[model samples]
Target chain A: MSQPSDIIQVSNPTQTSTKSALKGGYNPSLGPIQLPTSYQAQLASTASSKRNIYDHSLSRRAPEVNLSSLSYIFNVMIQYSQKNSKGIQELEGKLNTLGYSIGPKVLELITLREGKNAKREIKLVEILQFIHTQVWRTLFGRVADELEKSSEADDEYMITDKQPLMSEFISVPKDMGQLNVNAFVAGIIEGILDVCYFQASVSAHTVETPGCPNRTVFFIKFDRDVIERENLRFHK
Target chain B: MSKSLKTTGEDLWKNKADKVNSELFTLTYGSIVAQLVRDYKQDYTQVNLQLEKMGYDIGIRIIEEFLAKSQVGRCQSFKETSEILSKIAFKYFLNITPRVENFSTDGKQFSLILDENPLAEFVELPDDEKANKQLWYSNVLVGVLRGALEMVQLDVEVAFVGDVLRGDDATEIRLKLIKILKDEIPAGED
Candidate 1:
């Protein structure tokens, strides 16, 4: 973890004497940048620190958005994809591609908040749990319903999140055959998987679990190559 | 008095539960379009001509947030960014981070292993073959990332390396960081 560099204080030498009576207040340049108005006042109020502390304090007060907005956008995305698509498979493909595109950007944003304390996840299981909990919470406002190890393979796992936000109001028409309205969600999962540098296969499938209203399982199978690398990392 | 109070109640009910309300989407779309028109001196007709144009606009800003929040510094190579992308960025933002398992000796090539994919939760591929070809829903993602990264001056070729539709065991996106340009800080002094 790298410590943030010292905050660069740009003081005007000409005004240094005039401002000395003010007890070396905030450097004008260091004043809150063009943050959203909602956050500007909060940042300004907390901007009392003379140097690096003020910068860190401002960054801390930065606005964090709720998952509802993303959910609303995703709902429209589903409608848009449905309107534009020719059939079910094409929609799924489209959603997957969409998820792929957003994956890298999502990864970047999440890691930035972790700052220097963030560590690279070396173990396969640990990374999986991280995704099931942290990624799920950030995007969906709740951790996955369950995380299960594959009975058939040691390297495989299943993360289930019932009532995913994208699927909240969607009901796939039977006539559309096997089309899942939640393909967009699958795309997001695909994006996360790809960004995490997991060279594995992931597929979203509907499983009927008794008493569970929205039982959906994301079956993730790691490539043999991944297994080999995990082995090496474990031994090392 | 009863009728007037009833009308007010009805209005509140409608306001609170209007599912078909396009206001949020329209406002977001409108703001982006307006900005484009102002920035490029284009007409409103041209602005309405391309609403998807706004996706890229949002992508550029969103990507900057991702970079700042992730605090990913200059990587020695694109490959390193790939690893950081999977482990740190993916984990922090979306939570379902991938594990880099398969690495070609060249270090330029590797595979990301995903165990949990949140987006895929409750997802099922449509069974119709025709729908598969016509609906390229996921293509927007490729464009979003491409546009965002390009704006940041990281010219990289991104594509879905593999997919379950292709009968491959796993879905994979192959991102080849083609070039890292010299950091040209934006025109206005930072």
Candidate 2:
């Protein structure tokens, strides 16, 4: 246990802590599969000398790519979504759905990787802080600039990212009013929240500031039941 | 022939490109391929085609940035083109310069032996025979090469010949030049 046998080394990009988990017998590339508690020990051994992505260690830092490469791929995804959808809402919905699936995988990966100190958060503020710090840091290389509670609403919280990467190059056409690509980011937050037992909906909005033209605010609204649970567990 | 290109590539990757974590990019590509597979009902051939088409779209526009950033001149022969590809083009974008060897006697074809592939980093193919045999996990690279070459006025066919993800000994992408196309002028406009 001291040697950190679970510690990884292969430049592997997975977020999970154990061996690679697969839904199909061979891989998990086809669709979103609900991961079991120890997703790492689920792989079947192969007879071939060759190895799969799961054979590598999951403990190493994830790799990096050129931002331009991501931007180009994002453009293609938008185009494809636009071609298939009838209107702006549907298109954003598709993009959100695409990113939503990524949320759980990331949560599992980051949580397990946190080692023994990691716990299943019960309090609402602590979990949101975890998202504001750990989740954002792991995904985007920096903590979100601000995490604030809405003064008028008890169940609402806001996480803001100045110059959001996903929307950096996306200038929605004049014809399409009020479409923010960061809706995909909001979906990711929602996915994580759902897995953590917090029922919520998340949305992305652009509120430009004096010098920061690309500022994005991810607005998260928790369900009434969740607020009630938090009040019962923590306050009482 | 390759040392200068390698230096240029390494220098550009070190400073010129604005880098982002590869996890998001890798996961994003995996999600797209998965979505395509689901949409097609596991008909991997169609998924491969869609991936290639998408890569081709990226290649055409990305080549402009490649040209502008690399500042290299027109390649006089296919040999030079392959060198630029294995060295500058791959490094400028992906940060890996694959080994270019197995040249054809006529100098029209060669294969890029990818020592490392960041795209399929965490990928493990499905056990289904249909998927194991039919799917080209990194088929998008094939389309990118073809589209980028077409813009350079060189008609070429690009495809994956061997893949490690499929239990093959190596991962190799073969490029064959069909013919150098002439830049044609309109019938009456010229």
Candidate 3:
């Protein structure tokens, strides 16, 4: 499966030294930096030089990224995590920590990508939705399965992903019952919550809701301090 | 008004057909051995032993991407990195971050304490003392962390300071910085 062109043959040290001497410091006589003749001709052929330049710049600036590859890796990660843990709660905790670790960084990356378009979400509901949609999409290449408001409390909410990539092939053994394989996703949720400045403990569990097949509810119990701060923000 | 659509579990199951069952993890292990055998012209037995060693190497490579994608930043200190290793790194990578406490400072050097290590959450050491001493179920973590951190240019010694499986209340993994390595400057025209 190897290509001869891709072999990356490392030449002798003497050859590198010789090449370095020939490619000495930049010459002042080279004049103001100019495109090679072929590139110049190509640029001249375009109808609108401005539009061509804009298109060229845009193409160069866009990073080549693959989402499916990320999903595959996430699939393996979930399997690996499941294999290491002995019980369900332990596995979930592991997943949560994993997600938590990534939360701050993911938030930073997303914010960086959004640039001026990014807005800080002050409200709990808005923040959770932002995580479910924006953050989720940026990382997972798709939005979450479900977003719901807590029936009992104003500050509580649930972000359900019918199939979290991490929990793709994880079938928890019967011996270690009560463990949800999607704990890593829960950890990611928890990380998002914390980074967004919502102090809350997030847990992932498989809840047997009669009508729901992918009945994984991310139980986000907000920190009392967060609720108090929200109240203060509202009153102000 | 029409309701906003949501991707259901059924939808995910339906989509599974498109995902190629590459057996990436198992295949990766196989590929490493195959490469090693071809490169060194080693026998199958030697290749198998080498493959087991390469598992830790693969873990190191995998964990680096895991760390980078997770967005974990440069740790403030060795202690901070240790906390992160148990709390965030372990959690994000595996979903079990060890609970940390019992921090003891010896002026120059400091030690972090751990409670309830999820890797060793339900594990127990063997009954025989000799057998118990040889059992290091979570040893892969030490090697993986060492390799991963080294790749990022942090020279540190990682060891299993304690284990709950051996009747301790918590499992303690101690990381001591041996030296500070220079950072890798990105290559560009900037």
Candidate 4:
């Protein structure tokens, strides 16, 4: 990895330091003039107010964006991470961390916009249904193919997608052993669940099916405490 | 006639592709930009360069996808190339066809005025004076154009000359065709 200073040097041929720029003291011949605390505070407040004013009229709050651009950006992200990574799992971890950062923000925004009159989900099944229908539809343009509880384990649940959107354009090499890059999506799911006070572990696995190359099954296992509480709440 | 022509063009695109939910796309782009801001320490120029670099990498591969999906052959002329780019490539991928205008007399330079930029769908430049002046919010488009054209044997310089997010009159990108690269034959094949 290149050092921050090295990157800055390469990026800016003129060698302008951002710190100096932020301080409004970008000059080589003279020292920076110090501004008093009161003056600086006033400037900061004015800046924020100006931003609010600018944002007030222009830039619609619509969340829609072109998917092709998003896919290209995601491809770049995957390629960059792959360059730095040692193994498939580490790359998955990096992607998960990336998705985790986004999950909470998306969850909050979607939940707020979902229904004007509906309440926040309290039941386990209600939350899962929300994830299955509303969240999935909002994100992928379709509901997940199936949501099933594990017959063998009460704590385990699965959300299946016949063709996961994230991996639609991705083709894993044969040499890389069992790389499900959909772990990034899994991390997003985990992040949403965690934000809603559901402690869970989610992992994406490739499930081969006839004529479907990108079929993914996301297995979610809730924490023991969550299951116990659910049992008590629902009287299961 | 113009209305019918426009609807036909849109219908052709609508029939050709599946539409994914745009919220996911918007959030993903927001995350990418936010990550770049963190990585570059809010140095807008560095952020622009890094985005362009990433776009360049994506453009090379995406061009292959474009060629496979669309029935577009090698452009006979630069005029044809720009027409296909604005009318076909942009329409197919973004569902918005930018207008190509302000062509130089030599036909080697032009500006693409994007009335609807999906990348800047929710973008607003910070009110800070330095950032407002320095940030090219959609610099990636320039890199994408450059990389994709280079692969098709056109050496070009592409750049964002104006941005609406920065309080410009409109979003515009300028492109100057440097030269057309000749195909190199392999040593043994020739």
Candidate 5:
């Protein structure tokens, strides 16, 4: 198999070990998909690389691209996902799956860009902050607008973006009830959370404030066990 | 005569499509293509086919957007459809107005020479034999044309004739009109 030259070469043993653990931890039964062995190796090698290493190297600059191409492709991806989907929920689920695949790689890349030899984030709030700032900036070119906690549910947290890139070009048909394409963004958040061992369910809701048309609120609800574990970690 | 009208039409649509974030769009597309290549184990042909299929899906829906934005009417013939495609549709989305030439004697086939492919703005193919022979970097255009034309009741075939990215002198996509689909009337209407 031919290798893409743009792939970041990673030699960090700790990162590779974590990636292998992530791979081993993946439930194969969940989907009948097996990445090609070569591709898997490429991913492994890619994951092992120090995060954000590519961004620093002035010699081999990462490709800079136009948002129009992405929007067009994503628009098609949403439409394609809609074909097999039974309902809005199913559609969102499919988009989530798509976003989930991108999360681990994105997390690693963003973290690498933040600093040298960055240790894995074990704290819940730290990880959330990483997602709110680094991940958001890397993907959307800006930090998310607000990160807040829910008063009613102790485990619930909210991340708000005034205008998300995913839904910038999308104009959902009126009949397609409450189809927040940002569900894909939520899926990415969920993927990052899952990889970090903080099990959470992330869902996107359109909380329109008068001026901002595409205002989206991603509600992240952690599993009970995660909250319990967090308390234990905090106490120690 | 119609050439100047085509230029004006292109300008009108270009203004509407300018809102898109060109950098993000380019990056996202590049990443997706890269991911597809990885997924297929560098099997360029499979990647090309997959990209075409994706383009087809995008084309069908995008046509609706095209019609809405351009407010263009139905083409009187296949020739006019080709004119609309190169002049309006390409300009509307990519800000590219490909030069149309090499028409078949029957006027059912034509070639589009893409002088500036925005999709391959910064793309450089890996130094490999398989990539040069097999990869059609912008194969998606074939599917987009095929799918969009099909929706307009023109059963057309589109294929990559050449690609500068793959070492060809010029990038071109050839399209052939198969047949015009008749409007289907419901059972009682006939």
Candidate 6:
């Protein structure tokens, strides 16, 4: 049902090149004097630290943090971003950017853990389901409440979570108006989708109802290029 | 007394603490560091300073939860404070209690050595020399300690002396009390 064959060639080279580029020279694009973008260098600097993240088993440490601790750190992050932001959208943008960085890393590691069953997804619907079930479960401890496609537009889809974990402890001041912190989660979805060539713009929206005040729906709109490829491959 | 504290910490972790998978916590912290790296644009010092400041903000709020959960009484001395931190605070929250070690002659200073850091899991610093030498991947912990201690009226200085992640002999944090805030209640209690 999915063409896992050809995409491997495309994603394979950069995957290897990524780690080896560490110890390579700084990118000229970042201005001459800038400290080398540390994250790229951070990806695979060996020997500097006696222990790497790999030396320890993924399941070794207790895989849990108290909710209170998470809430405290998350709140602090929001406050820090808010102080630096121009307005609510910018604040949400920063959180989205912050969550975006975690997206790819989580996807890769989780895929690795999925082992032999994991296959590269080439179909739009398959990748969306993978995200709806696997990605959501791993990140938030449960499958999202629902995943539904838009009736109006073929390229638009929505994944709804009744009580999104990220914004549970957060109460946006009434004046801010409709800023869903789950934009961070949306950034995560976009991060995963972009890295895998699904090429979607994901945004978090507050769709509060009397029954579910914390309801958030992540809107995923595929890029023209991605939709074109899907039409060429599947529709034809 | 310390044994009781350990049991209390264990119970909080086992039952009272509402838990989430540490994977999200670890990755989120790592990404925050990466975002800080971009925001500061290769200025590792600013990234580190900002991380510590962020941690401090967390520490202030986190203390209320730590205190309310454990029923820990006012520490009789800085030595006792260090023990509770390693045994109880770290245990129930991050799930690793750094070994408290190398006490200064005055008893005002001490170091904590971490065997496993949950935050830095799967994290490797950039291959660049300056980034490796200058960056403290987990300086937020230092800020967290300072902020949390300050909330309890313990004015303190905390920094990463060494990190195993950096290929140091051990991952250690040095904490020194400047003085107890003598005036009245904690700063944020209003």
| iRMS (Å) per candidate | 18.4, 4.1, 19.5, 4.3, 8.7, 3.2
Per-residue alpha-carbon lDDT of candidate 4 for residues A1-236, written as tens digits (9 for 90 to 100): 44433432323422433333233332343345344455456446645433322244322345333456667877887876787689988888777777777788778767666557546777778888888887788788789999999999989999999998887878889997588888878888888898888889888889999998889998999999999998998886
Using Cα atoms, each model's DockQ against the true complex is 0.02, 0.49, 0.01, 0.36, 0.15, 0.58
Clashes of 3: 15
> Candidate 5 on B20-133: residue-level lDDT in tens?
434335544555676578778999999999889999977787788878878888988777877888887777777678888999999999999988777776465655557868
The Cα error of candidate 2 at residue A230, in Å, is 1.0
- Model 1 ranges with Cα > 4 A deviation: A1-72, B1-47, B50-190
Residue A218, candidate 4: Cα error in Å is 1.1
Model 4, residue A3: what's the lDDT?
45
Higher lDDT: candidate 4 or 6?
Answer: 6
Winner on TM-score between 1 and 5 is: 5
Model 6 spans > 4 angstroms off: A1-49, A58-62, B183-190
Q: What is candidate 4's CA lDDT for residue A94?
A: 73
Q: Which stretches of candidate 5 lie over 4 Å from their true place?
A: A1-72, A79-144, A147-158, A162-165, A168-180, A186-214, A219-236, B30-46, B74-79, B124-131, B186-189
Better of 3 and 4 by lDDT: 4
lDDT for position A213 in model 2: 78
lDDT of 1 at A150: 86
Q: lDDT score, residue B73, model 3?
A: 66
Give each candidate's fraction of reference contacts reproduced.
Answer: 0.00, 0.64, 0.00, 0.45, 0.17, 0.75
Note the Cα lDDT for every prediction shown. Answer: 0.52, 0.82, 0.54, 0.75, 0.75, 0.83
Arranged by TM-score with the best first, the candidates are 2, 6, 4, 5, 1, 3
Model 3 misplaced regions, further than 4 Å: A1-86, A208-213, B1-190
Q: Which number leads on DockQ?
A: 6
CAPRI grade, predicted model 3: incorrect
Question: What are the per-residue Cα lDDT tens digits for candidate 2 across A21-78?
Answer: 2342322332233344344233333433667565687768876778888887778778
The sequence of per-residue lDDT tens digits that candidate 1 reaches over residues B1-190 is 3344334333333343223212222222222233334544544334333333434444565566556554456666656666665655444433435666556566655555544443332222233443223322223334445556677677766554544332345556555566766788779978
In terms of DockQ, which candidate is stronger, 5 or 6?
6
Candidate 6: lDDT of B29?
Answer: 82
